[model samples]
Target: MGNILSSHSPSPLSDANPSFHYLVPHTAYKVFINHRGKDTKQSLVSSVYHNLDNRGVKVFLDKMCLRPGQYIPQALICAIRSASVHVVILSPNYAESEWCLDELLLICRTGAPIVPVFWEIRPSDVRMENKNGVYAKAFRKHNKVGKFDSRTLEKWKEALRWVSLLQGFISEGEQGEMVEKITACVARYNEMASRQTI
Candidate 1:
């Protein structure tokens, strides 16, 4: 994982209208975290969420952001769509979870900018796996049941490939450093976006 700051020459979230980082004002959350909860929820993700939150950056993690209900909160969808940025924590089983993959599919559909954190995985691995039958069987099942259109799966893969190319911080040996960098990046983005409106 690579952590790049404003000096990053190739960031979609930087330079061009960087100050236009406006997120939904209806909620306190500024970032929508898309990750497989079982993978990083209790560990790195939680740490990062707490770090950002402590620094006054609200993050939308499902457990904390979701309303109390048996069904997925509609607010969660709104949060995803309206959030200024999406921090997608990519772990080994990220692709296997229908929940994670479907949320990713939705994030891609929104055309929102993405910040990918590859934890214990490589960019090439994500690219290669997504290109293959990453969620093929589940997609086929969803299609067969008329629950979802499999074509969107292509969009999700495409999104994964695109984000994998971005210079996001990778966490392998020094997870703390990666988390620090990620928190800084999110804070900077929030500052820039908020600046534009003022």
Candidate 2:
């Protein structure tokens, strides 16, 4: 009779092979832009996209790629998950659109970093505490479905200011200050990737 045998967990490195353990290719950092399609012309979203693209940043803008007859929600979720960053272009009408709110909720739930540009609106207008504002209403409705707090809002604001510097929106005298912040963020991401490589 064959000897009785017991199964054992494999060693952590048992399946490791040189070819399989080779360095993963560094893909271009993708950025997904969430904005109202109607605001494409003369909107901050368009301007920021242009600036970043000009600087060789890879960005995914819906207006540039959304195909007709396609399911937008699915396409957007795919893009958001694939992206390294999500840029939300906030305007007075932004909260009025269910699609924009859905996109924001998805970004929040996915734990993807967000950069919210307050275009023609104040930060207070986007915060959840402002119960009477447009953003407040949207947030109130959103809270029923998911968790989002002021900290998340502030994080988005920080990201926005951080990216704005990279786009050269700061004054000539204050440009260095902004550049320092943007460089720090870029350096942090690079360091994270280096650690993963090791």
Candidate 3:
């Protein structure tokens, strides 16, 4: 967990829906949690998801939202599109998972308000500025393995850069404080969305 670190907001998101070919809204899940399951699912994700749920926030977390036999990609895509705000938990092993990277790419393209919580990694790591670092190392491995094409890899890099620039929380060694900040940020969006619909 971390404390709040306000960075300069990035440029306004493009109005275009880049992933429209694959994603379409199916439900009104207000918050989408994009995280590395291995790193934060049991710890930070569980904490945040429950916190939001108890506060009457409708959240789309794969573990809690997906049924036993549902198609995962389709379900996730719909959830991403339907959500009003996104909470991206960036952990050290986050970029190592192709699934997380692809999810992040989709989330970025959605143009939704994203609250990036740097769990245990720095914003520089996510921006890929640390050339020989963990985040960059994961991309290098992905490139070497031939699993993701150059274009897809580049898109992931771009998504990382985009998220790293957003005003977000940095880990200050306190999980409770970080969770409270994220919850407040998302609650504000939820309130705004509710008003817009009214």
Candidate 4:
């Protein structure tokens, strides 16, 4: 709930040496937000995080949960596995970052119910249907890098395609309405998760 570091500040893939001793210990979360920080962290991400927090939903947002010296990827993966629901905010530049793609892969692997928020983009774009779109361009750049093998790239693409097929909210600029719908979905899952633990 505080003005902690922005979630986009840490590029998990860029960190050459990932450590764990400095991580801030935390309790279990009900919702794990998998988002492109630059696209939504300041807007929809903050709104959704605060809204769910106000409603007593324990949310895991990197900006609020991560500290300066924590192992970003490990901590994030832990958060993803701990949550009951994952809200993936896919934006125009979502595929540009390897970190975001890795996070998406992890979220898909969790097998938890995902609430995909297609912000300023379509499901087809996310599914790599439009070769000229932002996602395709991003993937092209990644392919050029040679840092990721072909199989890893294919896995990421598959994850994107799979999530695009799920029922999710599309924000065609009406952010408030989108946030409310996402909040409702998250809260519903949180309630279900709470009940299962009893």
Model 3 lDDT tens row, 51-147: 9998999999988887765556777777888888999988999988877877777787677789999988899999988898789999889889886
**C-alpha displacement of 152 in model 1, angstroms?**
3.1
| RMSD after CA superposition, every candidate | 9.9, 14.0, 7.6, 7.0
The pairs that clash in candidate 1 are 1-170, 2-169, 2-170, 21-193
Candidate 1 per-residue lDDT over residues 1-198, each given as its tens digit = 112111222211112342333343235457888898888999889988999899988788877765543234345566776777789898877866656765665676666567889988788777765434434444455457664344444554566676789888787677788889888888888777677668
lDDT of each: 0.68, 0.52, 0.80, 0.82
Q: List runs of model 2 lying over 4 Å from the truth.
A: 1-29, 39-41, 137-198
- How well does each candidate superpose onto the true structure, as a TM-score? 0.73, 0.54, 0.85, 0.87
lDDT of 3 at 187: 90
User: How does model 3 fare in lDDT?
Assistant: 0.80
- Candidate with better lDDT, 2 vs 3: 3
State the local distance difference test value for candidate 2: 0.52
Q: Candidate 2 on 11-107: residue-level lDDT in tens? A: 1211223343223232234677777767533545566566566656666777765666545555566676676666666666676555665555555
- Candidate 4 regions off by >4 Å? 1-23
C-alpha RMSD between model 2 and the true structure: 14.0
- Report the number of the highest-TM-score candidate: 4
57: Cα error in model 4, Å: 0.7
